[model samples]
Target: MPKRIMFTMGDIACAEGAISAGCRYFGGYPITPATEIAEWMARRMPEVGGAYVQYEDEIASITSVIGASWTGTKAMTATSGPGVSLMMEAVGLAVMTETPLVLVNIMRGGPSTGQPTRGQQGDVMQAKWGSHGDYQIIALTPASVQEMFDETIRAFNLSERYRVPVFLLADETVGHMRERLVIPDEKDIKLEYRKLPTVDPSEYLPFKPDDDLVPPMALLGTKYQFYATGLTHDERGYPSDKEEVQIELITRLNNKILKNADKIVEVEEFMLDDAEIAVIAYGTPSRSAKRAIKDVRQEGIRAGLLRLKTVWPFPERHVVDLATKVKQIIVAEQNLGQIYYMVKAAASPTPVHLMTKPAGMPQLPQEIVQMIREVHSS
Candidate 1:
């Protein structure tokens, strides 16, 4: 259980984290900024008695991962922007069927292959709504290489616990950045495995949830013969078209995450004890927010940072509370105000300004401090 110091990229650390979390199946395709994850998984999976496959495309990659997940082992996949676009249908399939899996999206600049080498968080909103229809997702944004390692492991835990697809939304900057990461001994890492069915073969239901709205998932090879489909399904996993069944099916899908918002979302507040303005950021932009706060604090200004660790379920309550305390809020993001609009909606009555830089570069601390000054002036 000795701690080991290893200097590595965020993607490499993420692959290692998945391995540590007992992920036995990695089905992925190689893509820039995220290929290292797949490469590392290929090298390490077999050594640990796990399976790794380089699929034909992103679509096939995710499709295979979803199929592997039904076998009751932890499953994962990694890709960049375009790959995420290709996996949208697969995402919906996983959601509709309530299959648990972890997807790591190492974002690059994009509407369509925008910037391959540079890191831009243009997928913030897309991650939430990319898949058609209404379903809630649990997404974690890591601010550092260390968090990239830590959060990926947590992503699998959340995905398994909720029986839903979870995302580790890392930007290209973090994915490519190399830093010293602490590789804790395997025995020290607390990992979460999905809940399994306990009922007799005659009584098993694939979509039937326990009290937590997460069902006891049974492996495909088990004695029970279960069924799953993307169509509206009842507790028995059979397709149903009746209004009452449809209502129950969709509501449970949304409620499993929305109702458990308190348990599913996490946020970190820095130096907000008595702040007049706040900087709201996550992922790479939050790094600038941290530095900006330190700079402003020395100038006799009361500024703070509200960094979101779990972005989805969007931290509405915490954001509103901080807005109530502060006179104004600044949302700094690498893209053109993807999350800024969300902050404005939640922080009503309190002015929320957008500090957006879409050139695929990280926002500088000075720029954020200047934005804070503007908030003070207005």
Candidate 2:
């Protein structure tokens, strides 16, 4: 039987999840709402024979995690809004180089230091487009401490399997809340590592993609003498100025995740089958949405909750399908209206009601309930 334990904060559970998922390397700088993750890793990594380092800044921290990941170790880092902004360049590097690493962003208000210790989901759009380029990123959002534990493992697995960087996008309330988490045993969990070329160094080409469009990664000091460059390159990892090679490389980079979106997307539905009003949300706001739905149901209103777990490849198709059945869709988010537009676009003809609070705090259940009532009356 799996052991169940109560955690006081989501950051603690996230750290524990990384450890359980075989992450042996952690590099990060301390920041609000997410500092506990780095602190926990600092104390726990030593006991597990893993390495944890608090770098001078977020740039160095993310780059170090990428470096460690290339050495055949599962590596990860955690940060909040401003820290994530600082790591954007490194995130672009990871995507261009196809580095399998995990980044946990416990989001707070931002543009630049909007809120240090407060809660907000303003980084939803940033996670998708912060890095400059047409590359695809896999980002997951967790609503509770238990999800923080579970989704960290999934983020790592997706990073390794897809041979790309993945993001665990959490916010303040979810990062600080305590909940009972049932962690799975090692045998019960399926872990994936990047595929390595079987051929000798002389015959190996690092950027040459396999059948799955994922190239086997080579270690820096290994027998392989391959090069990794930010510029467009062919199968041999050399910098090529050829337009065709550039197109193919960019297409493959974007399509690898885009084509396999079904495998990467995850969401939860509550009373969606018969619900006339659908409440769409993620992270901490999702918890409030669930509560709001329960309250509305008690009042004989046919309401439901659609909690998104995978936020990057935004569950557009699922939202579209759900829209056909619901009379109105209410999006409750900590941000003003980041995902609200996506849900609206997905729902098309179906009306989308926005219930957003841009303040540095979690959306209250009462506020969500009020939004639902207003939408119902309208």
Per-prediction tally of clashes: 0, 0
RMSD of each: 1.1, 1.5
What is the C-alpha lDDT profile of model 2 across 125-148, one tens digit per residue? Answer: 998999898989999999888899
Best by TM-score: 1
The global C-alpha lDDT for each of the candidates, from Candidate 1 onward, is 0.90, 0.90
Q: Clashing pairs in model 1?
A: none
Residue ranges of candidate 1 with Cα displaced over 4 Å: none
Candidate 1: residue 344 lDDT (0-100): 93
TM-score of each candidate structure, all chains considered together: 0.98, 0.96
TM-score of 2: 0.96
